[model samples]
Target: MDEHISEAIGRPDLIRLDDGLLCLRFETMKVVSALAAVSHLLDTGVVRRGDTLVDSSSGIYAYALALACHRYGMRCHIVGSTTVDHTLRTQLDILGAHLEQMPPSSSLKLDQNRRVDRVREILRENPDYHWMRQYHDDVHYLGYEAVAERIHARTGGGSLTLVGGVGSGASTGALTHYLGKRSVDVRLVGVQPYGSVTFGSGHVADPEIIIAGIGSSIPFGNVRHDLYDVLHWLAFDAALAGSVDLLRRHAVFAGLSTGAAYLAARWERREEPGRTVLFVAADTGHRYVDTVFARHQEAARVQDLAPRPVRGTHELTLPWSRMSWDGSPAPEGALLRSAAAGAGPGDGRRASKCQRSRAAGEGATSM
Candidate 1:
């Protein structure tokens, strides 16, 4: 364990969890690991203590940075989006970190780049702020690498396919680097939401994706696209269903992104049976209780759509996209037509209808 993390989480209770699913119990330790990485960067002169650690985070990274700053006595600034959870914002404020909210833009979505731009603007206004630039920071992965090392050790360094969601792409890249150097046999698998364009896909402006902690609008310098042996993009519904399934079946309540990672792992395992497929459950799913777990509300939203069995490499459509793109008013013809016909009950057949409806609109940018 990193010295900074050891101090934060303490030694005896760091890795101990109730059921070994490693959900809520490990959060403090994860935050500690993040702090340790930041401290290491500061100690090595890669980043200075006075430098402002800036990141475009939904919540977790901001929370981590806030705690890390508290430990290192560094000022932390976050470029936050409007879509972030209100509870997370409150916690950040309590941590004494400054938040720069990015105004929504047409061409440039409320993404990491927008946050980066906001950070740049703040720095321009105050020359004293040094952007920590987590996207480009190679040291950010060192702590995550420790996790990979632990996984390898636990798994006996076997040939495994690691599946994980990409936020800054730091964790995936760092794990790939560490595992790759340790052995040439391990495969790295990256998962992203359908609308994310983090990899080489075009930019998406204000995509309505529910899965957090993955899919950035801007690309990270350290992300090794070529290193990934396989890539999978999951739909919001599939990930949502996966999360539900995990809770119902495995009794694991993981976040949507972690659910997406688990789905990808299962999908890969189905294709290549008997293969050791390891996936990281990034966070717990308690944060999404109002969204993903709200049975009645979510059902009402997708009442017009039905579930369908998706085959190989199928596109998943979101309910919001059925309305219109640019969040503009729907076409008069369709609006009038739907009103006249009246939306009917959503059966399994509505899946194809939803797919066709979204297909007519602009396709999502890949990440």
Candidate 2:
């Protein structure tokens, strides 16, 4: 392995969270595995030359897909959001991938259909464009499956508590299935921002948030709801704080959504014990320096007051009347606590509860 890759894998101290949950840090491995899987597909004649690959991606996945397409000598067209990170846009350009941005909109809400529309438009314009729909793509799941298998192998196929946010839901869904197939006792925990409608119903039913590419506005086809044993809803402020906390403590700079996943992992650690808790730092935080780290910019937005909803306590009703993907009733009480109690926490059991109160009334904030 290259030195950078080796260094990433060699960090033993880096794996354990403060709460003693084993942090899997699957982002790096997921990207590397995605590349390897694509390479394998090319070598095995699954993906041929001159194929124009199309995908609706946020930033990180776009970068990965762009690199994969370049290595495989395939033309790539990325349908991305206007709210995407500028650095990601530059990276995609450097990789020679055709980039198309969504239409302008003043609202913080991102139209999920925009990218899908672009894909349809491009495919209509060119007959050879093969849409690599990550939301429902088997290849996407295959790549994530490799990461889950590696986690299982590393832990001797032992039970673990997994937590992460969904962009396309491929990572959570695939890993859940992969681990279960190995008969490893695992609890898949899905995290989403307050404004996001991807995982659960919330006060703000926005399809997507400005965090750009971590969670979807629409429920992805591959999200196997049954696979997720627990769901944790994180607020943008808490996510931002978690990102800052990780930077201060571990020197790990990660994106806002990554921070959300981290916070969810922390929540998992507090409630459960004896089982390793794995969280995905979805992407690096360098891209979020201006947005999350800038005090001046932070001052512009109104104060966020969304109460981090816990699983128990009838004080807070389910954010939505019904679940988005399935009409199943939302869980009552503290969601994270319920999951942790059922799954069991890491070796060190520290019970930390959410001290913040809910926002005065129902109002949505732009993520």
Candidate 3:
């Protein structure tokens, strides 16, 4: 079949946000990664005709897998968070994906925990079904090699900083590893919701924020702590302000994670004036219009009373504590937590399968 959209996946447009800041539009980057992972399953005979593809995602990865399964003729089941609303539901339905969504959780951690639990249950019942393990699998990391190559080519080896949410570690982690392999001075800055369990943030039994697709309640195996040089944690209102300001200023309607990264990257550019600071716009804001904009309509009325400024000045800069990583190996006791959580190896057996294939270099199966 002659492909169109998948062919365009991972090819990002470099948008000059400021004099030195750049926004790499990468809505389809995950699709490129997801396609590689899906193709790996099909070509390796690990999964074949009539086999189902199972994974847990908040929204974007689920949609990416849905697209891949549509093109490859495989059954897909997505265990989703409540943020997977009717808009995403309609798209997945069109792609023939069965979505089982969890109720509205106050935070991404709870949602992820529940979804991972559901995914494990499905894998147990249907052991033959190939679970994509988007969160814990190393194969997803392999999917971003081309992205790193493009960024390297785009910058022509000038010093650069990568700014993005450390979700699943596929995009940001893999990009840093690949770029660093070329001997490029890659300064990696990680952005996460204030309540994420990743990057030294203790898991809140119920975090106040639920920034999906970026922050995680659980430790992601693919996320390499050593790859990151700096980190920032943004609260819900802070990220929401950035998202709104991005649309207002740049007219680029991006997701919440993008805004968070954008805010981080903008600040980084000011701090590191000599480097070309590049950040990611993961997906469009069409999905985030409600939470990031619509629900906050009351702000207009309040704007008149206080004559409010453009963006609410939140944590534009991280405190000294948030800036420096502990330099410790693991997150206090991630192993003990994982064991008590009963999520086995890389969260589950499915992740183990993906890691094995990645180690064997099966992701490089050519066209």
Candidate 4:
């Protein structure tokens, strides 16, 4: 068959959000990560025809890797989360990807760690299986260069800002670096849930946070904090409001992280008018139907799309299109608190954690 999933993964659709901002929808922006990484591995002969491809993913990445392995004629094994449902389960089976899901973990971080542990166990049993460390791998960054290049070419490298959830540091981080290398003023607005350890957000583990694929409870090895001009610790409710609004006004059904980015991009545009702001929608709304839009109480909250003043908000906005006001910590998040005690820089604690990960043969990657 000539049809391939990887063939339609990048140069995502761009739609107008507000006066000057646009939504760089990526709910369908899967497959590119696997395609890019697998291509590099194949070209360099890292693994050949009988080798199996293995990776751990909570959702979208799992499907992408499965599609990639199928295209390349490599056997694939996915260490997945309990969150994986029957629909996706059937899809994986159809694609000939073996999947082993972790037991139901309380929090997203625990689920992720459990999946990682499963991967380790699988690797031990089959040592030849190549682990596509999507979380910490630098090769994953290559996937978004074409995306960034396309945006740069379309915008003529003028004033632009890219906003998206900071997960694995792959999409947002790589895009920022790629555009910056082309001499474009691509300001990065990184998004994370309020409870994530990323960007020094509180370490409170939110099991109720329905949003997936963004914000890490652990330190991400690939995240370059300096590359982010600003960070938004989005609350689940706020992100939900943004998503509902996206569906209602724009008819662009996207996931929660997309809403967070969309809201942030709109606020950024309001603050600095006449600037081209773009945000990424990581996935379609189908995955979030039961959690996000199906609930009646939460649906009521979505009626008010405007962002209001909150005590600890990273930024503020009005609904999806308008901006009432914005707020920030006086000193900003200059002193981000880690899981270890105390806030601020000049600490060896996080470095020690990273080093320990490297000592375990994780290839010097964070997360």
lDDT of 4 by residue, 1-367 (tens): 4466565764477677676677777655657667888878888998885579888777688888887888788888887788788888899999999988778887766776676677777778888888887765567777888888888877778889788987776788778777877888777777777565555454433445735677665555545555666766667777877888778878898888887887787777877887789888878889889888775255534434444444433443322222221222212232222312221112211221221111123421112
Off by over 4 Å in 2: 1-14, 26-46, 108-110, 202-210, 295-367
| Ten contiguous residues minimizing lDDT sum, candidate 2 | 358-367
Per-candidate clashes, comma-separated: 2, 18, 0, 9
Q: What's the lDDT for all of these models?
A: 0.53, 0.55, 0.67, 0.67
Judging by TM-score, tell me the better candidate of 1 and 2. 2
For candidate 2, lDDT tens digit of each residue in 1-367? 5433323432222376555565555334336434654666677776687787776765566666677777668888887766666777887888799888777666434455656666677777886676665554345566655576677777787668777775555566566766877788877777765544444443443333435555544434333444555666655565666677677667776777777677667666666777778887766666678667663234222123233445532222322111122212223221222121111111111122211111111111111
User: Which stretches of model 1 miss by more than 4 angstroms?
Assistant: 1-33, 46-51, 103-108, 111-113, 200-210, 296-367
* Candidate 3 vs. true structure, TM-score: 0.81
- Per-residue lDDT, model 1, residue 133, is 51
Candidate 3, run of 10 with poorest lDDT: 358-367
TM-score of each model, in listed order:
0.70, 0.74, 0.81, 0.82
By TM-score, who's the top model here?
Answer: 4
Compared with the true structure, what per-residue lDDT tens digits does model 3 show for residues 204-285? 3223354677766555555565566677776665566677777777888888788778777877787789999999888888
In lDDT terms, how accurate is model 3?
0.67
Better of 1 and 4 by TM-score: 4
Cα RMSD for predicted model 2: 10.2
Residue 296 lDDT in candidate 3: 51
